[model samples]
Structure formats: structure tokens, C-alpha cells
Target chain A: MANPLEATVLVLGEQSEIFLGLLKKHFSTIYQLAHIENKEEFLKDNGAEIIAVATSNNVGMSKEMIDALPKLQIIASFGVGYDSIDVDYAKQRGIQVTNTPNVLNDCVADTAMMLTYAVARQLIQANTYVKKGQWTSSFPLTTSLSKKVCGILGMGNIGEAIAKRAEAAGMEIIYHNRTQKNHVDYQYIATLEELAKQADFLILALPSTGETQHIINANILDKMKPSAYLINIARGSVVDEKALVESLKNRQIAGAGLDVFETEPCTESPLFEMENVVLTPHYASGTHETRLAMAELVCENLIHFFNKEPLVTPL
Target chain B: MANPLEATVLVLGEQSEIFLGLLKKHFSTIYQLAHIENKEEFLKDNGAEIIAVATSNNVGMSKEMIDALPKLQIIASFGVGYDSIDVDYAKQRGIQVTNTPNVLNDCVADTAMMLTYAVARQLIQANTYVKKGQWTSSFPLTTSLSKKVCGILGMGNIGEAIAKRAEAAGMEIIYHNRTQKNHVDYQYIATLEELAKQADFLILALPSTGETQHIINANILDKMKPSAYLINIARGSVVDEKALVESLKNRQIAGAGLDVFETEPCTESPLFEMENVVLTPHYASGTHETRLAMAELVCENLIHFFNKEPLVTPL
Candidate 1:
């Protein structure tokens, strides 16, 4: 068995200082992928010694990178989503994978509710109106979220949390999932088309998979009510950005509140110029409290894997 | 008794078309205060014929204005708050007062929660950052509202509604009212100072009264944690604007989410420049759905008053 303290762990991306400190506490040899100027030479010389890899959803390990790490035993991701990581390839190699889930559910759910409220209530535009000395005149009345339908896609733990908050806001919940969930009493719509047609706010909370990529295409967009809002806190690939841009341009949908995009760290997009949409930089789970918990969980998973114990949240 | 359709109603301010339509349907003689350029002359000629006054919280009936109309039996206001109206003087004259209250609770509560989530999560700024093509870098982690103390002042219907949403968001609810109520399970802090000191978000949801004016002065603001936020969905007079400005300037409090202002339609203030605050133009219940309900209720109260029935929502 590899010595837990001496095992080389390759950190693939920039992480919080706290996460790095925790990683250092558990392992002596920590190699940052960014620090390696000649990656090919570095992997040739030292990749054999790298027993573990640490990454996040944004900076996922690729198949080529996985192939380079001959002795990679585990891939511990810092976020709930592992779609970016080649999980199937890792599984085929008998390597384990773990993610920091449940810890981020609250923050992500809060983001969904926040986005829904912001878009429906015109919070950002209203604030800007006030700041611009436009309050001297009566501001236009906005749409109310209360007593409206909140159609959730992917009725998972995070979606359930979002539903709880939405219900408290007096919104009725309906959802669409591959299989109906018995635990929740919220009405289940059989198809995405029905959910889109009925929803005042269609929130995307599903994972990113090959099947889910571009799930919200032009056809789905056309089914949504012109007054309905699209709130995406899920993986960006779930939505076809081109179709969304076209929808917004033509006023096919009222607006969107997006925390994720097809290409993350998206510097420019047509959505930026549209006042109807509210965009966040893929920051659904970005909070001081939640990030600390998620980072701690990632470290724990890595530590537990090296100790040959059960993984905290193995996928 | 005056004929139901013939009784004259003097509408004191601009109103929604729906409200005006309803009023016109009930009363044949409907006089708009704005159209009467010579109000004193017009009142001298026709005030005795005015059986009832229809006004709004913004344009309230003053003592002098009430005195002008000798036959006035009731004042029907279009909003929940009646602080702008001289209720005591009207009561002394044996005149009844009515406001649209219960109809607007949900939208106002929704606004309170929207402001809270927006301020705590930095939603507005985050949205702007992404729009400004600044998403190439990681956005800053914001404070989370979950597991934090939400201190409410004035636990009325709207306050209770706000508490419900806050609870769903995973916040611990504490409140300070004039006296502790037996109906609620939330902890009641007898004093305002203690609640301010303990709260992560100090939300003001009380009615505006003489005794409550400037209640959140420098002393109360000074008692608040620097990390705590102030959310005022109640009347603006409930807070001392000058004191709040000073507190925010000095970083004594984290931020504020203001839906009302001391002097409304206020075009200029130091707060306009502050990025830490989220300001709305006194539009808490300013949704098309809620405003229509409020307007209809105002009309109903007027109809009920002239018909010798109980007022829909008597103040």
C-alpha cells in the first residue's frame, strides 16, 4: 500500500487557499499542474509517482491527462458536478471517483431561488432604475412570482430544496424527471414539453451527461410560455446557448437567469447585452460558507481514499 | 340615504385604470383631484356633495382636505399603509378609513425575500460582473444566508410571511415586536438592541406610525453587527436615513436592501453611489397582479361603505 503522507497528489487547477492547506496537511508531495511549465516532460519524469489527482468541475481531468498519470488511484473533485471529468474512463481503470455533494445543495438551491426572484421581479433593472435617478416617475409594474407555477427539471435533492423555498414564496411546484420521485408530493409532469408549457418559471437542476447535453433545445424553448422565465443553475450544456439567444432575441421567452453557460468563464455573449436576462459567472455554489464545506469534503474524500477506507461520497 | 350610483367620490391622486373604472362603475359623479386646478374653489362649490373620498397611501387625505368635504363619510385608500393619512382626525370626525391590506401581503413578502437574497448573495453585482465581460476570472465568494439569524421587527402578517420564506431558506428566525405573541414558534427578543446585535439580517416589517418614525436610528444601527444587513420593506420613515447613510459609509453594517425611502420619488441621495446597497423605488407590492388586487379591494371598500355594509379592510 502507498504511504498516505508521502503520496504525490497532482492538483489540476486553482483552488481556495484553505483547500490547499488541508491538502498539504494530509500529503507532503503536492504538484500543481499549473506550475509545471513543460507538462509533457514533467509527466514523463514524474507522472508515474502521482498517485492521486485533485480537481474541480471547472478544471476536470481529461482522458489524455488520465492516460498520462500511470499510477493514478483516485480523482477527487471539489464540486457536486463531475460531468467534466472522464468518470467512465476512470471507472474502467479501477480508479475511484468522489465529489463534494449535499454540502453545496443549500447554496445552489438558494441561487436558483435568487435567480428566479431576480428575473421575475426585475430586481436588477429596478435597482439600476433607482440608482439612475429614475424613481421620480412611477416605475413599471413587474410580474409576481407568488401563485405562479415553478416547474423543476431533475427532481433531485437540490431541486427539492429549491421547491421548498419556492413553495414558501407561494409558488406551486411541478416537476419532470426520468422517473417520478415518491418522496415529494409535488405534481409530476410526464414530459419536458408539458412542464415547459405549464411553467411560469422553468428551472434546470439536472446533471450534465451525454443525454442531457442540449436537452433544452429549440423545440423545448418553443414549448415554453412567452411570459415564462428559464432559470439554469444546472450544468450549462443542458441548454443550447444558440437556441436560448435566439429565443431571447425574438422574445419567445420572457427572460433567463443563468448561473452556467455552455462554455464557462464566458467573457462575451449576446445574453450580456439583453436587459431581460440576469447572468452570473457560474457561481451557483459560490459562497464562503458552502465553499469551505465543499473544500473540506473534497479533502476528506481524498484522505479517506488514501487510507483505504470507504469514500465519503463515491460516485 | 344618497343614491348608490349618484354619490360623488373625490379621487385624491392618480390611480390605476382598473381602480378608476371600478369607481366610475359605482359612482356617477367622480371628480379627479388633479383635473381640478382650483381645488379650493372647486371644494367650496362641490365638497358638500362629495359623500366619500378615494385616495392612496401616497396621496393621502389631509385634515384640511377632509374638513373641506362636509359630507365625507369614509376614506378608501389604495394601499396597505395609512401613515400618510390622518386616521385619528378622520376618526374624530366620525369618518371611517379603509386600506387594501391582506391582498398585497404575498408580493410585499416576496419583495422582502428578493431583497434579502439579492443583498446577501451579491446577485446584482455578480450579474453585472458577468455582463461586463469579467467572467474570465473567478467571482468572489459571498455570504450565505443559510443557518444565519434573521431578526424581524414588527411581526405582523407581512413579517410572518417574510419569516416563512426565510425559514425555508434555512435561516433561524428571531423577532422584536411591541409584545411577544403566543401564536408563533419563532423566538421573540423583547428589546430591539438585542435583536439587532444578534441578527445576520435585521428586517423591518412594521407599520409606520408616529412612535415608530426613525425607530432604526443611529443607536439601533450602532448595535448591529458589521456583518449584518438591514432590509427595510416597511415604510422608509421606520429608519433614520441619515443615520443609515452614516452607518453604511463607515462600514458599520454590511449593507442594506431598501424598498422605500424617507422622501419618496427621491431623485438624489448619497445611497445612489453605494455599491453595498440594493435600492428599489418603493415598489414592494408593485406587481401587476398584487396592485390590481389592491385596486379592486379599494373599489370594494368604497362600494361596501356606500352600500351601508362593513368595509372590506377597515383601518
Candidate 2:
């Protein structure tokens, strides 16, 4: 006989209203715990079989919250990055943890390339200059892309996408991944320090993990080419924010394009005052279509968990 | 025997100093005609073999000025768009016209993708939102490129580059060019009208010529999907400015990304006031390495002309 259709779901993350509408269709009664500051009260009131969380630089679920969820059978994350969630702890409790991946590869990769162009050509600064009416009679001659070495930290799906775009821009791709990415085609250095030494533009597209945190600290930055440009589309903790600000101030690196930060709504980073940096608010996959797809995948995972089928992207 | 260098190259463009340096090595002397008012005086002094015109959107050599340079053998334009130089009149005079081509393919293509991302994701507006300190959070989801049809007009070298990047972004590439491009294997349509009908994002990478001017008028835009976006890395004259402004205002098109303009320093255009549109100051080939490559190519072309060798990139 088939299992009874009586699984409760807890939607922990804030998402587009369109996504919330879709969730309501599958669940008997959707418990939106997004704005619920006292998550304990909400958790106690409405029991949940599956928990869904949207990953962001700010406001992630705590370890304590995971332990307290007695009825939580699965935790489905809205994005590929599940650094905020304790996957090991969830696995120990026999709770499946799943994330929306592969779907976000292109979206995240596209944004990384966007940031590269923005920094390489100073697109944002030029836009500001023209809008400010500083372009009295001439267009300023900005930076170029040809002949630059694009250094990638992670050679995953998104990092490879960035590499392809960089190759199109006449840049040579050099990378440092956790392990050999099964291809010996591109130039690969054993360490980040070695990769930084030869690169004209270094990009961070790695996932956030305990081993990867503060990988781009002052020591690594010191090994980078003097005229190099840095781009971080990966986790903020992967780069030391204070060291980056100092490097920008000192002109050790030519410029930077940053999307994610150690703390989001990153209103207080000293890097803000510098003209050489291009800042984006953790919007790698914040586009309408991509986010909606992520939401849909999370819903699918939830439905699959209740149906006793394997999750599409389970950890 | 090779003839001694006799041409007094009168460079009538701002930011021609580097090009002038290269020209001086081959020519007798170089004149930097910075302003339009000095045209008559500069032309009178330099009765030369060629009048190499360097025109950006802001700096253009007029037809009246060309009529004065009787000894001008060629108009070796600095960049691709020769709309500034009267190519038809030059052709009539048997003057060989040349533009630096193939060199700017990657750079311009990179800019096309940049503008596409900027407009589709509202990067500039988001930048403003963050800078104004109003972005305590991300806004409701808007646009994205995943699974959308990117309609490219004029599938020339730069267009192909843009197509590759867009395809990498998971957008389906549908292009319309005068003659089908032999290089790329992308899907091609015979007409702009048909291509625009299916596109979710229409990228204008066409040249500005008599036959091509105002190609993206109200009729073409009306055929586009209501949520479609427009990206122009080509000359601004190719688009009917007024029609675009109206389409954006009425929300007939979702937004636009304009790098070129019919009139630059375009402070008064309705497009400028719209938050939906992303504007760039024609920094398509604005990378440092690309600009230097373009400069070197210009020098080589000038040297080849004087030496009576076959032109490297003949117009």
C-alpha cells in the first residue's frame, strides 16, 4: 500500500511571492517561517516533515535549530551552496539534505563573467562618469581584456563557464581546484599561492567549506601579480575582506569585482570607498528565472521526500 | 625603390596621441587636430598623401572637412564604425578606406554580454540601490537569461563572440545577418523581422550604414516578446532612438543596454531617465591590452601603406 499523503513542510527562507504560491499547491498548509524572528515558536506551533532554506550571505539556519527539529526528515536548500547547513549533522540524524544544483551553473557563471567585464572595462565607473555628465567632450580610454591570464580557484561547472568566457575575451585560463578536475588541458598549479603568482586576473568560484575559508588572505594576495585584478563570486569567507580592502588601498592589486561578502548587506566594508572595486549585492543567482527554477527544484525535493522517492540532488 | 614617407598625417580625434606616436615613426610629422574648429587650419597646413581620421562617437570627421583634404589617399579609421568618415564619398574619390577589424571582435563581444547582463539583471539600478543605502535587502526577482532566445542582428565577428557567450549563459542563439556567417554553426534567420519575433533578448550588433540605419524601429521592437530586452554594442544610429525610448517607456520592451547613441553625452534622451535602461559610454574595446593591440595594428597598416606593401586590413 502507498504511504499516506500527510507530510508537513517548513519554508524557512524568504523568496519571491511567485515561489510561495507554487509551494502552497503541494503542501496541505505551507508554514512560512521567513519573517518569523522567533523560529522556535513557529517550529513548535506548526510541525514539519521537510525543511527548505534559501541560502544567502546573511541569515542562515543555526546548528541548534537543526537539532531542535524533531520531525524534520529532509532539508532542501534553494541553491547549490549548503555551507550554511550542517550536512554532516543532518546525515547523522538520518535526515536527507538536498540542494538545487546544475540548474544554477549557468546563472552563477554568467554573473562571474559580468563582474569580470565590469572590472576589466570599469563598466560601472564609466556608467557613473557619463551619467554624472563628466563626459564633457571625450570618452575615457579604460582597461582591456586581451592577453590576460584568468586564474580560477575552483574548476567546477561555474568556474569552467567563466573560463570559456575568459577564453573568448582572449584570456588564458589557469586554475587551482581542490583536486585535479579530470582534464589536463588547461594550466593547473598545485596551490593557490602558485596560481596567484602567474595570473593577471584571479577569480574565486569555489564552494564555501571549512578548508576553503580565508584562502585569499594577505599571504596569498602577496603572491599575485602587481597589476592583477581579483574577482570573488564565491563565498565571502573564502576571501579575507579586511586584507582585500588594504590591498585595494595600497594598489597591490589593480582592482576587484566582488559579489559575495563575509557579511551581507555588507554596508561597512572599507572597500566601498575605493573606485577600483566593483561591488554587487550577492546576486550571482538572484535573477527571476534562475531563482524560480531553484524554488521549483526545492518543491520537487519536498514532494519526493514525502513520496519515499530519492531526492533529485540529495547529500 | 620605396618612396620616402611624405604624408603629414592629420589626426582629427582626441585620444589619438598613442596612434600619433605610431604614425610619426612612418610619416614626416603628425598633427593632433583636437577640435572641429581647427579643421580648416590643420587641413591647409598638411597637404598630405593621407588624412587618417580617428573618430569615436564624440569625435567625428565631417564630410565638409573631407572635401578640403584634396591629397587624401585613404581614411584609415581608428576603430570599426566608419559612420563618422564619409565612406561613400571616399569610395567615389578612389580613396582606400580601412578600419581595424578582427582585433576588436572579442572586446566588443565581451561588452555585448556585459550590457546584456547589466540590462537583464538591472545591475546599474541595483548598484544605485546599494549605493543610496536603500538596499537593506534584494528586490523582487526580475529578469534572467536561462532558456531565453538571444536574437543577434548582424552576425559578424563581434556578433559571433556575443553569441558564444550568450549560448554559454544557456540562452538559445537566433541570429540575422545580411550574408550568413560561415564561421559559426549557430542558427541563422534570413531577416531581422523574423528573428525579433522569437527573441526574448535582441542584441543589435549591426554596422551603421545607409541600408542598416534605424533597423530597430518601433515595428521590430513590437514583434519582440513584451518581456524582451535589447542590447546594442553596435553604432547607435542603427537604432531609431525615439522609437526605443517609447518602447521602454510603455514597457513594450522590458529594458535596454545602450553602449552607443545617435547623439552622445545624451543627457536629454528619455532613455537616460528610465531606470530600466543600462547605459554605457561606448567602452566596447576599452580594455588596455585590446586598445594597445588596436594601436599597433593601426601603426602596421600605416607603415604598410607607405611601404607600398599589401594592406593588412584593407577596408
Indicate which candidate wins on lDDT.
Answer: 1
Q: What is the TM-score of each candidate against the true structure?
A: 0.97, 0.91
By TM-score, who's the top model here?
1
**Candidate 2 ranges with C-alpha deviation above 4 Å:** A1-5, A13-16, A33-61, B1-7, B13-15, B32-69
Q: How many backbone clashes does every candidate have?
A: 0, 4
Q: What class would a CAPRI assessor give candidate 1's docking?
A: high
How does chain A of candidate 1 score by TM-score against the true chain A? 0.96
Work out candidate 2's RMSD over C-alphas: 3.5
Q: Model 2 over residues B168-188: C-alpha lDDT tens digits?
A: 777899899988877788898
**Which is the leading candidate under DockQ?**
1
Per-residue alpha-carbon lDDT of candidate 1 for residues B1-315, written as tens digits (9 for 90 to 100): 334476678999888777787788778789998888998899999989887899999998899988999988999999899998999999999999999987888899999999999999998899999999988778888988899999999999999999999999999999999989789999999899999999999999999999999999999999999999999999999999999999999999999999999999878999999998999999999888998888878877888877789888997
Q: What DockQ values do the models have?
A: 0.86, 0.56
